[model samples]
Target: MENLERTLSTWIVRYRWWFLILMPLLILVLAKGLDLRFNGDYRVFFKKDNPQLQAFNRLEDTYTQTKNVIFLLVPEEGHVFRRETLVTVERLTELAWQIPYSLRVDSLSNFQHTEAEGDNIIIRNLVQDAPGLSDAQIARIRDIALAEPLLVGKSIPKDGAATIVNVTVQLPGIDETGEVTEVATAARALADEIRAHSHLSVHLSGMVMMNASFSEAALGDMDFLIRVSAGAMLVVLVFFLGSFGAFGTLLVIAMSALAGMGVGGYLGLPFTPPSASAPLIIMTMAIADSVHILATFYQELDSGAGAKCRREAMQESLRINLQPLFLTTLTTIIGFLSLNFSDVPPFGDLGNFVSVGVAISFLLSITFLPALMILLPARLPRFQFEIHMMTHLGNWVVRHRRRLLWSTASLMVLLTAFVPRNELNDVYVHYLDESFAFRQDTDLLDKYLGGLYYIDYSLDSGKTDGIHDPVFLHKIEVFANWLRQQPEVNHVNIITDTFKRLNRIMHENDPNQYRLPERRDLAAQYLLLYEMSLPYGLDLNNLINVNKSATRVTVGIQVLSTREVLALEERIHQWLSDHEPALVTEGSSPAIMFSHIGEQNIRSMLGAMTLALVLISLLLIGALQSLRIGLASMLPNLIPAGMAFGIWGILVGEVGLALSVVTSMTLGIVVDDTVHFLSKYLRARREQGMPSESAVRHAFSHVGMALVITSVVLISGFAILSLSAFYPNSGMGLMTAMILTLALLADFLFLPPLLMKIDKH
Candidate 1:
């Protein structure tokens, strides 16, 4: 290993010009493939074979692959049934059909009102001739809208102050990258036009807008968060590494980030919110390698006897740091690659991209950084205070080893005990902070009409035209009623509602006849009459399949935590099992999909992290060449994440998909400090034959400051990331920063004392 590193360093110095020129050109060539496009589709989070996603796909395929663009119309007078409001709403509903890919539009004006005159059924738009409607007609419209189950909670609020115009769009699926944005753009333009000409306040909210916000939030973070991270990194680097040397470190990290993101682009990975954070994470992680190499090089130059020239000093730095750097880089890569085990694909992309960045950083740190150091007149400021602080800290730990060992151990145990305080919870709407207009509009929609959180169930009766069977219709009605009874349910869109309405209309609009038909023939006839009277695209195709063997029931719930969402789903499933087993199926929707994945990811990431921990421990056992020290190293390496979780449990008490992979990420990162510290300590003990106490002091004096520098940089980088408007990115940043900070604490206070005690045996 030593000979290889020597030869590599010698080659780098001998062919410095070649390395300096070729590395950038290679990175540039890779950068040419950086054609990154942001995809905010909720589907991006799930794998193709994911059960919930598959169910959703099957459900959509069975009927319409509909994406919704809902415009919330809140009149200034807070009365939606007024003549002018009805007139404006009628015009807006007509205009909404013009939205690109719109397959259907439903609003107060377009709601199909059915009536009976002399045994003939009549179906037409509810709000016709809106400009000529008198006060009596407007009041009758309000009375009819409020009385209708289908319109009450789904479109118009029970209070009748606001209503929604929902446009059902079917994207061609050939160009999903921009189709959602196109729909949202057209919707927003329509909204602006309505606001300009009418007294109504229009706010956009629906699945399409939410998807569009994903791209908006991701693109916003890439520009804003990356710049914030870069500025923070610049200040930290210049302060710690001196101006000229810091520039080299910055350059190395920048090139590494480009390499990582370019590799992702070359691999055809779209930038989702999670993956969009790669550049900032890459910059943060890449710094550790450059800092380690440069710290040693500067130390050698300061020694005044270790090297005769800058080139020799760099080579010596490379020789000393090469093994530890390689070990850390490999372990980190292994840790990140475990993200492939995640249920969520975007997290896997994040992990893979960061792994690439870490590898590239290691390569450039040893080659590009050193070559540039040799060419540039780089002079780093000597930190006499840092050395003195490390020296004193080492002495302090030696003096109070027993106290620190017990105290830190007890604290770690106490914090680890609090780990269960964290409950798995993810709310997709809350993923974006209030800064996003989508979130604000969604909140308003939830406050007014109904919830955006919905669950879709495709209930199959298992035979042709089985939907008309009295028994099947009864079960559907029972389930819909059961859903309506749930506290979380804001609305239930069921075919039973239409059947009851049609039954009453067929019976000369008798109020007492507003119930399900008792006979199969009657139900079939009612459905046939209703479908025949409906206009094209407004037919029952969305609710009932062509064969009438199955129907879809969509239930909207108030905004709730993912834990609550999953609990409601469990309750629903249990109800179906107890009462209607044959009609039972997994609920399919973006909300349900996200709800299931957060729990699944946490479980999978833990398994992956456990495997990574085993592999990393074995590597440590080999690298340190001391089974005892390697075994001891696990104490510090593992405790930091547990302690961080404990702190999070106390502070936040909620773990989401973003927090699920923190253990794996921080495990790899925190190991770098332990490896460097333990390696230095073992060198003093085995090679110099120093006592354990002396070895502890030696480790602290040699590598303690480097650990601090890297920790501060990493922590600062992620802390800046916590400022992101996107919750997943911000939560990850905050949690990672917390873990890295704790890792440093464990390495400094706990590792030394534990080492001294363990080695004594």
Candidate 2:
């Protein structure tokens, strides 16, 4: 190992210029190749065989196959049963169907009105096909809507102030961004038209609209985050180093980021919201590694040694720093790789992409950074002010080590105990900040109409012919009733009860026929009659299945916190178990599936992170060849994460899907500080034969300034990310910054004090 180190030292001194030119060119070529080949889709989060996804696909295939967008309309004053309201509803309905890529459109005006005939129920379009309805005719339609049972208090608000017009769109494929954009634009345009022509106000809310809004927000935020983080880091580097040499270091870090991102792009990996931040993250991490090496390199050259001095400096720095740098990179990779356990596709992609990026940064820092240093002048630029500040801070740490240790420990324990454990959720509409236009529009719709988030339960009886049986119908009715009683459930739609009332009304208002049908055949006959009388666009697919074995009951839910969603789901599950024993295998809506997957992701990510930490800890022990030193090294790395989480729990109350991954990430970042501190202390003891306390002071005096500066750079880079509008990215940035800062303190104060206490043994 000594001979190899000496050989590498000689090469760095002799052929530095060759490495500097070749290394950067090679990186640029690789980056360009990857950039030309990159793909950018977000659906890669779900596994191909995910059961929930498969069930959703099945429903999508069998039922009305179209992507849907909902238009929620409201009046500022009075009920919607007026002639003016009915006319406006009809006009919007007509324009909505004319929208490009729209397969079908349904609103209060176009709803199928059903009534029982002799022995069956007859259904017909509420609005007849005509160029325009007279004012009197429109008034008559309004009166009928006010009197109708289902249309009265359900489709339209009970106050009659608001109503919804849902437009179902059929596109060629999910990736057809053009079609999605067109539909969203048309929907907004129609809303504008209604506002201009009439006094009525319209708000658009649905999956497609939300998706488009999210995509736009994500892209904009990505640009802002990158520019802000890079710009801030550059300013800091310039302020500290005060030379063109800082720019060269910055170039090396930038090259590392480009290489990492280009590799991902070359592999055809599309950048999702999380993955988009990988380049910035790679740059931040690389800066820390490069800054440390450069600081030591400059310090050695300032001592006024010759070629031998420069050669020895590079060797000593590399020998002392290499293991710690490698360990930090490995831990970071492990933490990021843990994200693969997340059910969310974006998170999984982020983990893989970042892990690869960190590896690239490590390699470039070792090879490219040294080459650049050798190519630069021996007497490089200096930061006299920063050097003075670091010296004073180092002196303070040595004096007050005991007090700092106690204070840190107490704060960590207090925060950990008080931290909240509220569940994390993904309410699609709520993901956007309040300042966004989409959020404002969605909020308005929810206040006037109902919320967009819903839980669709398809109750399959496992027998096609028995769908309309009295037992099954009664079970569904009871389940719907139970759901309505829950606070989370805003609306419930059960076709059986809807038609059963219509059948009773047609039987000369007889009380005997008011209840559910006794036989399966009678129920089937009633449904068949209703289906035949329905309009062209208004189909029975929303309420009934094609096989007739299962019935779909949709329960619209109000937006709530993640805890509320989980509690609501649990309550519904328990209610079903108690009331409907035979109603087996209930498939939930897309919204509910998102919440489930988020919760699962948190658990999986935590498990993976814990495993990674354990593996990293084991690796460190093997590398040190001393279990005592290895175990001692863990306190600086591990405690910071616990402290960060504890602080997060106290301050934030609830940690989400993003925060769950932070623990693993903190493990990797903190390890950098530990490795640097411990490696220095060990060398002072075993190689130079110093006592433990002398060794602690020697190690701190030598590497302490560089460690402080590197932490500052890392913290500054991550802190800029807190400005991001995206919740997950911001959370990660804040937590990572906090953890890195705490790790630096721990290494400077706690590690030395603890080591002092241990050496007494």
Model 2 is weakest, by summed lDDT over 10 consecutive residues, at 36-45
Question: What's the lDDT for all of these models?
Answer: 0.89, 0.71
Question: Where does candidate 1 stray beyond 4 Å?
Answer: 305-307
Tell me the TM-score of each prediction against the true structure.
Answer: 0.98, 0.91
Write model 1 residue lDDT over 1-761, tens digit each, in one string: 66897887788788888889999998998877688877889899999999999999999989876589999999888679888888889999999989999999989898999998877789999999999999898889989999999998889889998999999999988778699999999999999999999888999988899889988988899899888888888988898889988899999989999999998899987788899899999999999989988888888888875346989888888887888999999888988898889999999999989998899999899888899988888766786789889999999989998999999999999999999999999888888899998999999998986558889999999999999998999999999998999999989998999889888888888899999999999999888888888997788878988899999998988888888888899999999999988987999888899999988898899899989999999999999887888888988888888988999899989988888988887788889999999878877887799999999888888788899999999999999889988899999999899888988988999989888887984
lDDT of 2 by residue, 103-176 (tens): 78878888776555566566666766433667677667666676554564346766667888888888777555
Candidate 2 structure lDDT: 0.71
Error of 1 at 107 (Å): 0.6
Report how far residue 533 has shifted in candidate 2, in Å.
Answer: 2.6
User: Candidate 2, 507: how far from true, in Å?
Assistant: 3.3
Q: Which candidate is the best by lDDT?
A: 1
What are the RMSD figures for all models against the true structure? 1.5, 3.3
